[model samples]
Target: MQSIRSLAARRLRSSPSSCFTATPASALGPGSARFPMAIFAAQLRGIKASSKLQQESTADTIEYSKLSDEDLNEGLQRETSESGARKPFNVEYLRESMARRPHRATYDFLSPGHSHLLNIALWDALPLEARAGNIPDSPQSSASEETSISQFFMPSASAPANNSDHELPSGHHLVYFPLQRPISLLEPDGTDPAQSPGVPFVRRMWAGGALDFRRPQNMQLNGARAVCVERLDTPNMVMRGGWGREKIFVDVVRRYGANVADLDPSPSMTAPEKLLALENKVWDDADFEERRTLVFMRAKDDVPEEDAAEAAKKPKAEERIIKSPREPEYSFSFTPTPTLLFQFSALSYNAHAIHLDLNYCRNVEGHRDLLVHGPLTLVLMLSAIRSRNTNSQVSPGRFIRMFEYRNIAPLYANEELRVCVRRNVQGRAGDERSVSEPSARWDVWVENNRGGICARGTAVTHV
Candidate 1:
């Protein structure tokens, strides 16, 4: 099989050089030629992120007085209900099932075996610091001796940062998390670990890292100049042993790409406002909290065909079209013609089947079609808005809060789509210039090739 390194090099060679030609390291990052690469290099220099999962779980249960009664009740009730209704997520059962499943992790453009071979090698090379960033419940390294932390960088997949003597093909940058010490698969609530056991095919490869998006875009976005937009569709073979409670599987494919950020292209954004904007963009590009939370949103059941058809045909008024946002607005569009579907079985690590596999979706999960990954959607929005900036003055540390998003519609394959980002009028109310302006939230709308909106949402950025 052709190696991942060869594949990546081949891809770089095959694509037009003028658009995404590799730049010298000095020209990357924010202030220097090395700005773009440097940004990722900094990420590789892992920051001290608080690792409390940030999602609801038994771990979040604090002693009385601090958390509200409502918050406490929600957690307690949810736990009790889950423990009673379903068996806790079966990592073992999933592993065995995955062994029988067809899909495997894939790097874009590589032949299947070559992609797997290349990714597996990188999985072996992943740095411990990068691995530590993904441990749920704040697991510490054995070297730390206590609840400790270390710094590592999350490398950019765009450029071969490790353009070392040895390289993986497919050019997909990947990170793997191997436990410094064995963590029991047992849930803290005390469930039977033996109930539906499966094999331990990939207990060590739990991790997250950015894929070097290799595409370009030149368009007007939110009154700003646009940079290259990435295209990561057909998340077919990628796999992850999901960490924490929902230790199933995940398919992190991004088909729609983002536009890069430039200096206040939007004449409306002032100098200070633009800099302030960097704070949240950087932080979010760094954090993965919301994605972690949604791991718990799996409501699989067999909705009767009548119900499914009825829901699809429900007489809902057409999504009202709007001219502009009451605040900072963002919009993005993409083609999904080379239609793709990513399948992540319960076995391929910790991901659930909700992400891929149309049959499981139809028969087991009971949906109209396969559901699109939420993280993929969020990444698309961020990439879209980020592409619009020229200054690229982002600082992950300055982030403040999450805006909001209402999943306006469900996205499916085979149709071209557009994603839009815009500011929130309510957030800005009187606080227009407050780095905390109404611009924090992005009103996101996903449109199909035929110009129909499938989903809409709002996202808040702190930077």
Candidate 2:
């Protein structure tokens, strides 16, 4: 096999170069003079030999040191050798599982509810005083320690007394739930244990998403049930740098209400009676729920465009740089570290490689460094907006109704970032609040140290 160095040299030599012709001896100055035909031919032959030797010396080849394609993917390289190559993504397989089974999670009031957990999440997320501009750090009390509190009071590991449930704030549900199973994400088909040939090991990233809160979620301090219904929509292709960025969206509807059975554990209750109790609903109903779209992004080889017209539509990220706004009503800056990334991942039970595996990030996804979580940026932006309400209250008669965000560029760890939010002034007709415009809209974005916007979006709130 031709070594990489040799290949590079050959490629260079093959490239177009300046016109070259030996200068005539007559053009030479001083003692230089033309040679006889026979002598010139002999000299030309000798010169050609010398040139060949020099080329060989300059083109010295070195063996490729890094793992070969086969070595890096030894077992997987030949898995589908006889079957040719399989597709990198199985869209049909994912589509077939469109109707996902519902899942339920129950949380106790004192289980360091979303509020405390989110504050704990900030411990690693907040920037240092040296960089974050005196932004107060979260309480030193660790989430793990808070979680252990319930265990300590439990009479035994098997059974424990129930505590009153607390209400979770908007967007807080994202922090409380356990991480989704990573199986279908990596192996959608799961027909084989090992990946097939030509099937790239794609890394999943948290692209920004939208959340719609229907009503306030009050935790059943006495133990309420959260019924979560999820559906995996058909994946769409998002154009990235010469690649087809697959956007996989999962729609989740979480309904938090009373657990009728737990509300009254009557042993003598009949099946019909229990069913009736479960059917009974009041303020706590599915009407007051939240719908969330969790988007996962993966890169695939760019599909060839049909023609120039189609190709012209795909513009690079640089083309849209001017669209990001600069000035904002409020801005909160902070620097994120790898420690925060690790801690946030642990808190959210997220094991995405781009956030944790530097090798996978560089070798597979082609990132310069570990990526900061997109959800973390969104959380920080929301937190910054919430901080403006000095009352330290969440529901102030006005609440954010809908929020949509997207990741513009990847923000690496330890980078300084500023989260900015501006109230939309487009529809404002007067200084005084009016019923005609009961809701307000705001734009939110995160900018890197270089003032490049890494993420941007808009939010709608009903005052």
Q: Which one wins on lDDT? A: 2
What value does the lDDT take at residue 252 in candidate 2?
A: 34
Native-vs-model 2 lDDT? 0.44
lDDT of 1 by residue, 157-245 (tens): 33222222112211211111111111264422111122212222112111222222222111111122222212111111122222222
In candidate 2 the C-alpha lDDT for residue 58 amounts to 30
lDDT of 2 by residue, 370-426 (tens): 888776777776665554443333442125555666677788877788888888744
Q: Which consecutive 10 residues in model 2 have the weakest lDDT in total? A: 16-25
TM-score of every model versus the real structure? 0.33, 0.54
RMSD of 1: 21.6
- Cα displacement (Å) at residue 9, model 2: 64
Weakest ten-residue segment in model 1 by summed lDDT: 172-181
Clashes of each: 93, 9
Q: After superposition, how far is residue 73 of candidate 1 from its true place, in Å?
A: 17
Q: Considering every candidate listed, which one attains the maximal TM-score?
A: 2
